[model samples]
Target: MTIFNGYEQSDREQKLNILNLPSLEAEAKKIIPTGGFGYISGGSEDEWTLHENTSAFNHIQIIPRALTNVDQPSTNTKVFGLNLKTPIMMAPAAAQGLAHSRGEKATAEGLAEVGGLMAQSTYSSTSIADTAAAGNGAPQFFQLYMSKDWEFNYSLLDEAVKAGAKGIILTVDATVDGYRESDIINNFQFPIPMANLAKFSEGDGKGKGIMEIYAAAAQKISPDDVRRIVKYTKLPVIVKGIESAEDALLAIGAGAEGIYVSNHGGRQLNGGPASIDVLHDVAKAVNHQVPVIFDSGVRRGSHVFKALASGADLVALARPIIYGLALGGAKGVSSVINHLNDELKIDMQLAGTKTIEDVKKAKILRK
Candidate 1:
């Protein structure tokens, strides 16, 4: 029997048969470089927001309906005009090579097998072309980091368009990198050379070229650059890290076709509202002009259902998927996704919903 088949096993046996995301995280903590695990798993000071991200969901419950036929509930949803087999999408994660040799390419391949959407990080270890090739021409979105030079930024946008990325996600919240204690203690810099950044810092003399340029541009550039990049890319622009309704409106006004409501998985602001807490406001702010994607505090199919019920059009997860990859590479990742999909199907059936559209139809009570 396959490892995932827990038919006659006890709950404890099933739990220990093979590690899930959390167990994999513990295993990864033991195997990966001290700094990398901390960077990926640790949140801001005290990790209060990080705790809040996950815990907040528990306060909101899913009121399952009774006395309804739920034998064959459908779990399909379309994002950016593409029909995805499930509503879950993979979030953009950088330095994946640090986690595994297959890196983003392996992730693309695994995600392709299940018809999942993969979002490529701007700080990816592999190039855009490599990821696209690995996805076998599957629809992927390019996540962009705002830079010091508009011309150079536009050039990257052109490359993404040429690479066949379905959309562009501008990470607006990370105007500056946060104080990540894990990276500080372990010294985890991106594994690959950012060729575009190298030339931009010709004479910083301190031998800190890329990080310096990154820090300087983060402080110097205005939102106008974000507008320009959106104008330049024909692909739909998705503005990520939008915490407030005002920023959501600003992002929409800047020509973003989608808004990803995230707190950088609580890797950034420590005292800010949880990603789940602020999602409803952001969705209400947009008034349906664009689809709202959510991240931060998602680990199970129940969490996916919670986000959809709260108003997220789609949901993505970073650390869990990373843990899945670290534990078993592509197979581990595929297992987690497939499990989540299965749970989602059962959850929908139990809730008396037969379609993705019906997911948003549930009546949720908020305090």
Candidate 2:
């Protein structure tokens, strides 16, 4: 059982009391340093896509059904043979240590307590084995950022699988960093050691910074690489950073078990459509061949409900989750997951739905 197995949340929120995502960010801002906050919160260039990612939800109205059996509304779903008590999961945001001293271990602990799941990043401050242990048997997936050295990936994948990783999420969008003006204006770098990366880095790693590491990444990746990684790991591979129907189809053909729809939380491009705006079309393209996961601009239970209706198997968020970590350590992340799940349950009841399937069949009109 989790440390807060029966602890009341009202009493627990003393560290990070929050009403919504915005409030969560505000509360966390009171604690996290200036540079760290900007790195996590700010988007690329002008961040138009960043603003649009959330604002797009306002235009998509949920057509609530009435007079249905909604008494036993359930927010449970399964991904990669693991049960997600709630449909919302954590996106693989790197460098979580900057937000809290405990970093990914704290996140794993928090999610473990609440029956939630997460995908740990290649740049995580905590290693796969340690994070998995902190999870206390929670099913965890690992996200990969392929390096120039295939040997590094080979060792990393071996470590992750041996550590009991449930699946692999390959992020393909960010070969290089987005032009986040905030990081430049503040001249910030992650002060904490990226535990998973240092061992893989060459020649002491001091000369090879995170930016340099990304710069040296294999940029000419193709569908062939997906097939290669899947063959190597012998585990389910979800090709992340897919923004178009074509890429989704290619990934599916290349043996991707899942298709992740994301724009790197609008931290990649300045002028791209909101992830939600294109989710339906991408889902339509996949046509049930594989589970389509979504991230970018998910801040509410209604957003979770809508994404299901739009054809997402699971929804994810990053910045708000990190903020939760910054505020209350393990419990803070637990509260965020529980808070979103609670809203999803209430949404299912009020919208005349009962199960995860019903939510998928929910009527939503994009205005």
Across residues 1-367, which tens digit of lDDT does each residue of candidate 1 receive?
1111111100110111243455567776665556557767988777889889988887677888888756798778887898888888889987666566666877787778778899988777567888888999778998888766667577778778988999998887777777777767767655434433434445742223336646655554445756777667767888899889998887788778999999998888899988988888889898889998999988778888888888888899988877666666667667668878887887888788888788877766666
Cα deviation of 119, candidate 1, in Å: 0.5
Best by lDDT: 2
lDDT of each: 0.75, 0.85
Error of 2 at 20 (Å): 1.2
Tally clashing residue pairs in candidate 2.
0
TM per candidate comes to 0.89, 0.94
Worst 10 residues of 2 by lDDT: 1-10
